[model samples]
Target chain A: MKIVIVEYGMGNIRSIVSTLQYLGVQDVVLSSDFEILNSADKIILPGVGSFGKAITQIRHRNIDNYLNEIVLENKKPILGICLGMQLLGNSSTEDGNNKGLGYINGYVVKFDNSLVKVPHVGFNQVKVNNKLKLYNGFNDIPTDFYFTHSFRMKSDVEINQCYCNYQEDFVASFERDNIAGVQFHPELSQTNGLKLLKNFIDKF
Target chain B: MLRKRIIFSLIYSDGYFMQSRNFRLQKVGNLNWLEKNYRFQSIAFALDELIVLNASKTEKNITEFAKTVSDLVNDVFIPIAAGGGIRTLEDAELLFNSGADKIVLNSLLFQDPNMVMKIIENYGSQSVVASVDCKLNLGSYEIFINNGTKKLDYDIQKYLIYLEELGVGEIYLNSIDRDGTGFGYDFDLIKIVEDITKLPLIIAGGAGNENHLAKGLQINKVSAVATANLFNFIGNSIPNARDYLLDNGLNLSNRVFDTLDLI
Candidate 1:
């Protein structure tokens, strides 16, 4: 299968590509070209850095157009990791109010620094919704995944959401049919992450 | 619940990985030898994070070290923090582009606070890890920088507060006295500074075995435990240690997926 990882001068594209290759995926391409994304069997919207800057870069490359066509119109399965996941939400309050792809029904906000440490780093337990294809093998258990971000997403709608609690529970991952997003780096989460990525490839 | 982490650190000097003992470098082997012996691709399963530091006492080359980091991280799925001689923003950018999820800073935090702030501004606070080397002297912890060679005028408590003010995400506090001794972590040093800052603390320097790792993790304030003693925990030692920690009901991530199933 041809897996295209959207690259816009942000995120850990190298780690995602290397992880995909390790999972025996051969035709992995890191490009923001419309044709490359459109031709992909699956699309991974990997991202890091600020939300405002990320949105600007995505628009500059016209990746928002590519994603809309390939993922929304053509119905290709897509997985967004970390900040990539946040970009799939309705909007984020980071770096001024910035709009997202609105692929999922969620809003991103900064973690209450008064309540806990900002930029919650390291491995944290995520309560998985195994009913979703994104968390197939987890068996509805709490699993650890690497998280390093200040802003988190929350949704009122039931989009098959998984929750992780730092001080308060927030959306850890969600899957609405073919579209999926995880607020952790599956590429950097060891076997469990690899398993999740494999599910994204096969089950989705 | 946020789980504690078990991290493995690899000290690189020149072209070889060194066995560091009390801040002294002893060349062990090259990257090929490391892969042949440790097989980090597989060993990574046992670790929560991996830190590769360029401790080259001579002139440090960011490009060459970054290349080694890139090579070492292939197929190893975990957060890799690489840094040693990051003097410029481009130097920090090179390592991050190479595959580093976070950049470790030591001397830069002191020598160039403005440069450190610039890096944090560029990469966000979460992307920077401030590594502080400390040695106990006259009933107080003394701060050391530049690969533990130079001493700083700042006290340990004030230095930690300074790091927090610098907006680093985590603190990698390494004890120079117990560096590679394999005895255990310096609880005396850890106790004094664990609650000083709200940032996650990763205690390093003197972990010999699984017991040492467990002891370090038992501390409620410590977020992670790191050991660079290559000779002590070789082969399947790390994997066994993880299992041991899990079996003993430690609050570590118990999720295990067989990646071999993918192949």
Candidate 2:
């Protein structure tokens, strides 16, 4: 399937492109153009920065409403990673108050320090919701995955697929029909990460 | 279902694998080797802290390097803690924006105590990590900076108190003399730092095997053990560390490797 990765000048773009290429996905394009983004068969929004910076870029581009309409109305499969996943939420309190794509019903907040270290750096385990099709070929439940973020999604939304505990329970992966988002970077997740991308290419 | 914590060491300097006592910088394995073979269940890694040496030399370039490192790290799923040349609030911002989950600062904390306050003001205390490279000088331990090339006269215990007062999220204590020796960790030094601070402590330097990791974890004051040569040379992976820790009865988080099936 032809995939389009949203480029908004925040963080790593080449790595995601390389990952897609590694998964045998030849039809991948990184574009900031609205028409190109809206016309893609599959959309992947990958981010490595803060929630506020991402929301700001999306808003400045004036693609917030368009993204919401495309995902919620058209049902095109879109995957959001790291800050991209946080952007799928309603709002975030990173540097300041910022509004997200509002595709999911929740807000992003800084991690509570009482439970785990902030940024929740390094590798941690993830438990899948089992009902989602994105995790098709993995057998080791609670597998280790790389993570690097302070703000996480706190949603009362309909697409909560997986949750991980850092300080407290937070959304790790979520899916609402064709719209799926993972808080972790599937591209950075080594063999398991590649497996995830392969599943996305195969199933979606 | 025990969760594992992984440790990583970032070799900032240009160097190569050594045999016996001779050390030289040679082109070694590809980065893919780290991606493919060196598997740890959960790992903690390091950042090149080169701020105190000659700030003017690496100051402007390190921020961009952080971005490059972030992109490189995105291909691997293990947890990485980036240190080196972190000085101001802007440096921390650039690092985090570049995809660093944790920032390890040593020179900045000693040079200007307010730097921590500024970080806490912006990113909260939990995101700021105080990295202490300590060495025994005479009868007391002193803090060393600039990649363990310079020694500070300040007492390690006093600095630990000051770090606690500054409200840092975590502390990474590395023994400079023991680093890369593969002999084992300096448990006494770790005990001293742990006795002074309640924050989560990550111990680095001189981890040779699973037994060293198990011994380090037994300290109770240490939250995690970090190694560079051990995982690189000793052939121990993160999964092996986790299995050892789990078999020992430590309650770690549950990892689900089968989630790939959902795709």
Report residue A7 deviation for candidate 2 (angstroms).
2.2
lDDT of 2 by residue, A1-204 (tens): 679988787655555766676566778897878788788888988876567767778778776766777777877788888888888878899878987787777788987766555556545677864457777756637765566677788777567568777756788888777877888777656566667777777776
- The C-alpha RMSD of each candidate to the native structure, in angstroms, is 1.1, 5.5
Off by over 4 Å in 2: A13-15, A114-116, A138-141, B15-75, B79-105, B112-129, B161-170, B198-200, B219-221, B230-263
TM-score of chain A of each: 0.98, 0.92
Against the native complex, each candidate's DockQ, computed on alpha carbons, is 0.79, 0.18
Worst 10 residues of 1 chain B by lDDT: B254-263
Specify the highest-lDDT model's number.
Answer: 1
Docking class of 1: medium
Residue-wise lDDT of candidate 2 within B5-58, one digit each (tens)? Answer: 446554543222111111112233333444454432223221111111112223
Off by over 4 Å in 1: none
